[model samples]
Target: MLSSLVVSCSITTSELLASKAYGAAQTYPVAPDRAWKIVRAIVDTTAAVAVEERREDGVLIATTESHDWHVATRFAIWIEPVEAGTRLIVVSRTVRPGAFPRALSEKEFHRDFAQRVVGNDLDSHGPKGK
Candidate 1:
């Protein structure tokens, strides 16, 4: 397990919905609706098609198509509206343990997800930034 290693980044602004939601979405490059399109593409084009199983109360649950080495896996994305901004919490759990390994998936996630999801916003405006 990752101990004391809280990997997170955020952007803040005066615009409640704008800065909060927009900043949380780094790779959007446009508005929220456009961002959704980008997100949908990522999920659809995954190794195997991953469909959203549950999405309620700012939380999303998705499962990938099972394969030989890649068994079924669940990924959760939690969007929490905080006082200053919205917090995006992400987690992935291995349901089947799979024939290969799940950590590879985790690494893949770290590789492109962060920047694609919210790296742009972070780059544009973060901490003392605009």
Candidate 2:
């Protein structure tokens, strides 16, 4: 028998930076991390990755994105806020890179990512909108 896994693991911080460092971390058993890695690798190679890195307090923050007309661009962002709240903010967007020839498909992918991966109604709340 063979297994075909498109996504795996959790986008959990504790699991990722677990080996990196830090404590008081949390983990979520989902497909965000794997998805993020996959998105980055695919876009970075096929297209061009424009990334930005920054460090705050003790956490390493980064946002990587790529653009291509033939395929959708991956937008995976993770922000851990430490102050009055200890939470992670993520925004994953699969856009058509930009508006050009096939802009309709880009719009479709964006809609899909929002409704499926993240959720439908994205409020100023958590994943559960609480």
Give one digit per residue, the lDDT tens place, for model 1 in 14-129: 11123223222322124443334433444444542334423344544445545665545555544545554444444554554335444225345434444555544233222132
Q: How many clashes (backbone N, Cα, C below 3 Å) per candidate? A: 3, 0
- List candidate 2 segments past 4 Å from native: 1-48, 56-70, 81-86, 97-130
Predicted candidate 2, C-alpha RMSD: 14.0
Cα lDDT tens digits, model 2, 12-130, are: 32333443332223323335443343223323332333433233432332222333544332232343444433232333323323443321232332333343244423222212432
Regions more than 4 Å wrong, model 1: 1-38, 47-50, 53-56, 82-86, 97-100, 103-107, 117-130
lDDT (CA) per prediction: 0.40, 0.32
